[model samples]
Target: MTMNEANTYDRYQRQIILPDFGVGRQQKLMRAKVLVIGAGGLGCPVLQYLAAAGIGTIGIADDDLVSLSNLHRQVLFTVHDIGLNKAERALAVLEQLNPEIQYIAYPKRLTVENAFEIIGDYDMVVDGTDNFSSRYLINDACVLMKKPLVFGAVSRFEGQVTVFNYRDDAHDEPVNYRDLFPSPPRAGEISNCAEAGVLGVVPGILGVMMANEVIKGITGMGTLLNGRLLTYNACNNQVYELALQVNRDARVSMPADKKEFMEMDYDCLCGVGDKGFEIDYKTFSELVRAGDIAVIDVREAGEVPAFDKFDVVNIPLHQLSRELSQIQAGIVVTVCQSGQRSLVAAGELASAFGNSKKIYSLKGGVLQWPLLHKKELS
Candidate 1:
């Protein structure tokens, strides 16, 4: 055998020796290109396994930075990686794990303008993102491009896996994410991992499972999760699979063509916009410094890393209604651990005050405040 062939065999010999997965399957893996969005919990294991499996080209897309809280679940990063971009950091670590593979890091959030361009280059896509806006955006982009997408999601103790926009045979019509959830959930209706705490192992388990599905799909070796949803409960270690049916009516919610898709506002549709009242940390800082706005910490009392930089009212979301009178300022801003509860609080405030008060939710919440403004604060 040639030196290169001998090396490839030595590297992946364990998998190559499997009953059905031999050098042929390994070769297919080496030729497949996959793009993984969100280098957080799920993306970490998915990237690690896929890289070790020798996927020819892997792309990492994420705009978030490594933070203390992420270390528990995002295994790819360490304490030293804090404040560093997740995609770039993941790329660096993944390269060390398997230098034979090629890695591309897009240190930016996936949006409509860039989704198609980046996704178009990959044969299949993996949905590791946590938010509804990104989930729907990636799903729609994959549907439009007719690319297969492997999806994974984790909550408090439950995790789910599925494959979208994939067909096993020529006669079958493919099903996309929209076929399962036609529209985005109303903001705050479904809490993410940030809002509803998740056990670190939940995502780690689901991420490895997602990587398995990707390999299965690429090498055509096993039954794909297409048209099926598998849900796992880590608490009891129970697993169940549900058959997913196409929702024809859901197609109406999808963009008619690429033109309309590019113009769509997924954030607003997902309720993250809060009707244009969601302000970033910079805007929140400016408003706070102005001393004319009432900053309300919607998180419950005793939450860690308290925001004591300025005078603010401590009102948990559950008690916001009874304490509405406490906020005397005409301009109000809501804050929370991860902005989910604050978005709901802002909606409530808007409902109560109408046009009489300018109500806004601090996007990304207090957890990200110090990270985003450390330079200015220091």
Candidate 2:
């Protein structure tokens, strides 16, 4: 046997010995190209396994930096990687794990303008992102490119997996993500791992499962997850599979052309942008100390420990229009648990009082307040 063949045999002997996967399956894996978005929790396992499986070209797309909190779930990184770009750090570590594979690191956020270009080069895309904006964007882009997407999401103790835009041999029609979630959820209506707290193993399990789908897609090893949604509950180790059908209405939401898709505002669609003026916690803290602006907590009354220092008013978002008289100040700031509700409140206040009155939403809200205080202390 040739030296290269002998080396390849030594590398994948166990997998090669399997009746279903042999030299041909390994060759298919070696020729496959997959792009994984988000180098956080789910991305770690997906990258590790795909690299070890010898995917010919793997792309890592993420604009975020590693933080202290990510160490628990983002296994590809370490304490030393904190503050570094996730994609670059992930590339560095994966290369050490398997130098035979080719890795591309995109140290920038995926935007509509760039999504098509980057994703067009890959055979399939993996959705490891945690947010709706990124998820929808990747899904729409895959549909536009006619590429398959392996999607996985984790929340607290529950995780979900599905394959979108994939054509199965049994079905002539391909199923895309839009068929599952026709529209994005309203901002603050749903909380992420950062807000709700996810079990460390949830993303790990979901990510590995997502990687398996990708392998199946590349090698045609097993039944693909097309048209099926797999949901797993780590708390009880129970799993559920729901059959998904294409939605004509959902298909209409996709951008008609490349130009339109490129110009689509995913953030706005997801209710994740500043509709009104926004102020950082540091600046809001300064305003609070100076007693220049009134702080209005828009969260429901029973939400949390009340704000003690600044004479803040607890006006739930629903009552803001009726209780406008309670807030006497011309300049006001609206705040919520995580800054999302506050944005909505700020917009309402701005619209009600007109442009003459200044309104600002506390960016990052009460959740970020303590972090800012800690930074000040440090």
Candidate 3:
């Protein structure tokens, strides 16, 4: 039970040799339990480093299977792991890397109904998920359960890392993700790694940064990314830290007597707040075909199969920011497969081009586009 005990400092000797993270800190890490919400790109490095660093227990929560595309960034899986459950593959890797750590593959999505179950056991929770629904859920769960959340996110050439709900004797305020970003930018505003094409090591860098933050929180040694956001632009190899403060103006307005932690329609919440913003599909299509608007299809090259072939211009969301000068402007109509990414793209474009330009995004995306009975296949 002591710091200098046998077999204790042996595994974590390298970390213990560091100035701030010595034997006492290594012991804290070994005694800590960390729950990572995804086993994808971000989760892989987080779980691997934490396990190797001697974190006593790690819970991997995700229900997704490894796809050929995932191998580009999700380092936990290999050619043999293709089609296998992400959490399952990750657990096997962790077991091989560090048998001393108890790695738990929850092998299920973190829904509102069950987020608290596994999250409650860990010393800190890491939001490694890559969706708005999951991100909002993680943030709310942390706020409700009073758990510290170490967050990481990545896109094509950018990554973000931050700590939320962290406070000790000196600082008692709990800051959630909502406090930093206020709301999810409407879909399409930000592109996913799948759509935007992220650098394989982007998540690795951010993930390790997240692990460092969690360790900092446990030992209370250095300045955590608490109330601060660290943005890494791989394209430029630059790291910038932005100050984050509780936005009184944007505090989530919730019902006081709202009982139970049922899923907070993040799409709806995100719709109203800054989180991916756009109109439903029907209206967006109407404007695009009206011959008076410019339709921007913010989908990747081969993602989701282009829904509209009729006159819509293909400007993938990640490239849209730079390709705007090339957009044929009539009143712009932004759309994607499900409308999520398009909306985000639309919002970002509007921010740059002002709102009065008559730009609109598809609501339901092409998937939600209504099919006429006359077109039914016999």
Candidate 4:
């Protein structure tokens, strides 16, 4: 390491002073590589602390943009970052916090194709991703590579944390993500934060826990939750840790190859595909500009103050099933008051139409639709 590198260790003085994590363990932290998969609710705190802890290299992968709604929980971005890419905003802040460590930003959505590529470079994968598809993809990829994943997920006020697919490959037994939830919950079965609501600090607690797990795993100290699940109920201030065992039925044979890691259709894998799917407004604009896809509005009729210029059919959610076939084998845009209905309807379309057709969920529904969406249809 160069002279500038020598000073990197000095930045972690506060943490270095902690018992068992003196200069020696601190050095390990400085040399460790960590990847945080999302920059949302759980991710903000996870990345924030990891950077501050002096992790040598950190990478963040998120394709979603910051929104007013996200600002309430994803503390990393502010109002000014409303439309900026999440990974970009997180990287900007993280870099400033600790220029001592190298920070990389994967501003694209984490997909099966790029999941491992994005995570394999790192030693620990901090899962802040909300959707099951991403979770399975990340877990599957990590298991295949024998990488340790610090997983944290929050639903409403309840949160779950676990360390799966650690370095210990004794008997080649890998505790896969399926061990937690054997099957993906149907789309819209559980209310997402945007629909149901979550306390601002819920993900923060879970995220910080994940960051702690990463730190412990890197330094090889503390009891890591390798085959256990830790659940926290902030509303009740109750915490529980339960041991986990590999499921014989779901003990996915250690992936046969790396291609398996990239082949999962998170759309279908996470049940999001079943509800249709989401594409960024920018991407929707691109597809519309190309003049190939049809946009559909699933919002309730008269539910919103209409100012749309997009050539979309106002097929209300209640009427979606009847008019389903009306939509061609083209990209469908689902719109709602904020976005919940559209997400639900989108999944409906995907399940029936299969993956050949494209479906996109408008962020924040029509509430945040960009002016370009109107300009294109007009």
Order by lDDT, highest first? 1, 2, 4, 3
The lDDT of model 2 is 0.86
- Listed in order, each prediction's TM-score against the native is 0.80, 0.79, 0.78, 0.73
TM-score-sorted candidate list, best first: 1, 2, 3, 4
Worst 10 residues of 4 by lDDT: 1-10
lDDT, candidate 3, 309-361, per-residue tens = 46667887767779878765658778788866776777778787886576677
Tens-digit lDDT track of model 4 for 114-226: 77677779888888887777777777788777788888888888999988877554425757677877777777655567655789899989889888899889998787888
Superposition TM-score, candidate 4 onto the true structure = 0.73
Per-residue lDDT for 174-257 in model 1, tens only? 777888888876676566887668999999999999999999999999888888999999999999998888799998889887
How many clashing pairs in candidate 2?
A: 0
lDDT of 1 at 147: 89
lDDT of 2 at 67: 95
Candidate 3 regions exceeding 4 Å error are 1-9, 17-23, 252-260, 272-378
Please tell me which model should have the higher TM-score, number 1 or number 3: 1
